[model samples]
Target: METASMSLLHALKEVLSEQQVTENQTVRELHGRDESYHKESLPDLVVFPETAQQVSEIVKLANKYEVPIVPFGLGSSLEGHVIPYEHGITIDFSLMNKILEVRESDFLVRVQPGVTRTQLNKELKKYGLFFSVDPGADATLGGMAATNASGTTSVKYGVMRDQVRDLEVVLADGSIIHTGNLAAKSSSGYHLNGLFVGSEGTLGCFTELTLNVYGIPEHVMAARASFPSLNDAVEAVVSILQAGVPIARVELVDEPSMKQVNLFSETSYKERPTLFLEFHGNEAGLKQDVEFTREIVEDHHCLDIEFETDNAARNRLWEARHNLAYAFIHGHPGKKMMVTDVCLPISELSGAISHAREAVDLLGLPGGIVGHVGDGNYHTLLMIDMSNQDEIEKAEKFNEQIVLYALERGGTCTGEHGVGVGKQKYQQKEHGQALHVMENIKLALDPDNLFNPNKILKTKDRG
Candidate 1:
């Protein structure tokens, strides 16, 4: 190791145990990249801090040495959120995985940052409760909060921001602060929870989180509706929402994605534009809602609708939707996946998606569209050989076109996928003067740009 790297390692080892710190090439390489197709840049060292105090001490040491600190969770992020591009210290939170307390009465849970969604849900199952933010990946709760992630259930349950009741975050200078409280609502000072939830670690590192959970519905039903065209499926969703159908989850999978799912999951779903729908409530109420939804979809020329009430069948239906991204990755052996996420107003969603499909076809790329369309968010999954400059350029153009369409219609470049390095360029265009306010917040919280530098916002220098 170089002198500077050795010095930093020694300092980290002093704060954490030798077992908690590593300079192994394999470990560094794993920490250097995320699920995104973005290029990787390895960190100098990786540390597994097991407590908030340990995280705070490590941050203090990094500040003392004038080095960057990137907080890492499961590294399942799709926008380079966990990649330590600055080659400094990457704090891996895996060791801190623990569900500390379950406030069953209050419908809340306190957990360490490394607690994954699957792990937490398994525990919540025993309490007849569940965490609603299911971002497809079994991402850590801390990482989900960092990205303000939302998924299928968000249509009814709201996003991660809504689920987060409190966050125990370690600031850039090693100070610990709670952004919220257990109270359901409060006229509190400066809604820090809102500010930090989607800050994407550009603000601080989360150590512990207190989140609101929900009781599992008394009755749950899952259904699949196939439409003749993508436009018809999306329009059905819009009408369902307009009529107040109270959908628990509604996801759109284009024909191409449906084929990928059938191939990967070993199922014989009809290869067509499909809407995976879910309902939650009493059986009688859900039946009424389901009937209304069926009528609405039928009006939009839905070819066929199938309902699944059995646990096994419901799991299989959602699993197919959740595994769509991985299926695309599996289909393209030597290519990396680049997913474009943009959300528009409900009335404009059909047009936005239509434009996106046209752009993908024009670019002549192997891509498919899928989304949690109940909330006007969608993604075009593209597989590209990074070495092929022409393909990469075309993919970039396709993403730009989709983002531009959304922005022009008062939509966001990214709805759930937080602005890591990927969506930074659209910040100024989307937020306008508000981007300056965000920059000021970053400067005030992390003046030295030590936390996840070059993410979310651009800085002239690391210093």
Candidate 2:
């Protein structure tokens, strides 16, 4: 270890218990990389703090010693959001996993930052309540909040920012403050909740979160509709939204992705442009909605449609969709995955997706396009042999093409993935002068740039 890192480690050992601080090579290596294809950089030390007070103390020590601190959850972020690029202290929140409280009447739940979305939903299910945001992986609520993650259900319910009612954050200066209260809406000082939720750990660390929840609908229906072409599938989704169908979840999985799902999930779902959909409402209302959705899709060249009301069938259908990424990884041996996503306005989604397919064909890359089409957000899953520099560069160039297309058509570089190292380069192009304002905010809150340095905004030139 470096001399400075050793000094910081000694100071941290004094503040936290010996067991809480470690320079173990295995642990550091594990905390070094996330789910992205980014190169790994191990931290000098990994610390597990159980309380908000301990987090504050760690932040103070990091600030005092001029060391960077990166907060880590399950390391499932796709954009290298949790990688310790600066090689400082990595705060893993695994030991702090706990669901603190549940207010059934108010539809609110207080949880520690380490609590995973699946874990929270399992508990909420007992009370007939559930959390909305389901980001493929069973990501920690804190990590989800950090990225403002959303998925298929975001079409109807909302994203992570909408669900978060309050957060107990530990600032860079070792000060602990609550960003919001339990109320539904407020005309308070500043919208700190919005600012902190998607800051990507560049602003502060989330120790606790109070989030909104929803009751399970009285009746639910799941369906899969196959279309002849990608354009038809996306156009069908646009029409569904325009026609005012209350869709709980609407996901698009292309033919290539469907093949992977079939191979991995041991099911024979037709390998075609398919839309996995769900409706949440009373039985009578859902029937009408499903019938209406079927009619709209058929008009757009839909090949076939299948509906499932049984729990087993619905679970299996969604499971295949959720596990699509893993299926890709399983199919391609000895390759790293690079998943890039962008969001466009619903009106422009058809052209954006059509452009994406053309790019993939032109590049001659083995990739698949899938998305939560209800909200105009989509992802391209690309696998590459990391040893080949040419492949890496080509994949990056392809990603840039897709992002530039989104930005040109009034979209964002990332729909759900936060601006970690991957999307930092496009910030200026997408946000223009507003990028400067974000940098200023980072400077104001973390003047020393001690929190997750070199992420979202680059303070120094890269080689």
Candidate 3:
């Protein structure tokens, strides 16, 4: 086995620079896991491919050797999407990180998959534009697109799929193809861009992407609204959305999560259910929206509402929210974090969240609840000691209960966190006959199941 592994490594080095290919134990360990609680497994080898042609060649080698190929970005995914559990070759795209072209007038930027959300935004800022799909982890664009990630601003702008206009993909057979064109909308062929966005690397490796960008809004206002209860916070979001305030972002961080934030961030945030809110529009329009939003929150029995007046202050507000997971991890020493998110219709969100809170309390888990709740999606963060089987079982039960509850109410098992291994069992229940069509599509695109095998569409080996 060691000799065969060396043979594969030598073959990979032949295709690229020797420095770009490594089988070092440390590098393999880093590529094995993602930001989830799933068991991590190291790939036998790791390859850094700097071009679409390089990616194509690597995929061809994987197919020739029947070794699984898993595409990796920044390893920020929360649902174990990038883990090379089957242990083959992991393609790391960090060297391919570059901003290729910025078509400012066209509101499109073409970039390599290795470019990150924050990095792309930094570059786009010079052009008076910004990429709106922020999954909050500084995740790579390819990984974000793989998971179809959306974040706080999704309520107004849209998800990752909405931002991606076209994709340059290398398929299972090493054929490079562009899934879509630069045109705004096309009826010319199958909507491959959308189909591939959430496929979770089960289809092909994305090499380059043409994405839609938006001009920075004229006026931006951010606030934190503390509510008396979790239900109150969620209800206020539904009311705000229904009222059409053109809210750019509204997040729900429950009471416990607020405590975690205060502890980890060294801020005396109110130890109660809170909603982080942001509005983008004209100055006069934002003023009116802020006034109206204040009224709505007050109607929902908001305790206190405070607005961040400057860019630094606003960034601090969202930064604290984005770091909520890290806050929980910091608070729970030497414990793994289990996060589950569900999406319900706005009407069903309050009840769903209430149920989640109850389940967490009932299970006696130390955790927090924070979410991109403006779009009826929320995440529950639970800290579990890996050695404690009882705690793991209870956490699994908690996850199952919430997923079943949401599914019964026309909610999905996940909203932003893609269906990696953790959520595969729920796919059939969630999609029913539609799941079969997805299977057919997967088989059609990746016949040998060599591309990120056993991820979204589970194979019998893992199941």
Writing each residue's lDDT as its tens digit, candidate 1 over 1-463 gives 8887788789888889989999899999999999998989999889999999999999999998888989999999989988887889999999999999999999999999999999999999999999999999999998999999999899999999999899999998899999999999999689999989998889999999999999999999999999999999999999999999999999999998999999999999999999999999998999999999999999999999999999999999999889899999999999999999999999999998888888888888899999889999999999999999999999998898889989999999999998999999999999999989988989999999999998999974875
Quote each prediction's TM-score: 0.99, 0.98, 0.98
Writing each residue's lDDT as its tens digit, candidate 2 over 290-330 gives 99999999999999999999999999999999999999999
Off by over 4 Å in 2: 460-463
Residue ranges of candidate 3 with Cα displaced over 4 Å: 460-463
Where does candidate 1 clash, by residue pair? none
Q: What is the lDDT of residue 45 in candidate 2?
A: 90
Ten residues in sequence with the least summed lDDT for candidate 1: 454-463
Ten-residue stretch with the least lDDT total in model 2: 454-463
Which digits, one per residue and each the tens of the lDDT, describe model 3 over residues 193-280?
8899998888999999999999999989999999889999998999998898899999999889999988888889899999999999
RMSD of 1: 0.9
Report the error of model 2 at residue 459, Å.
1.7
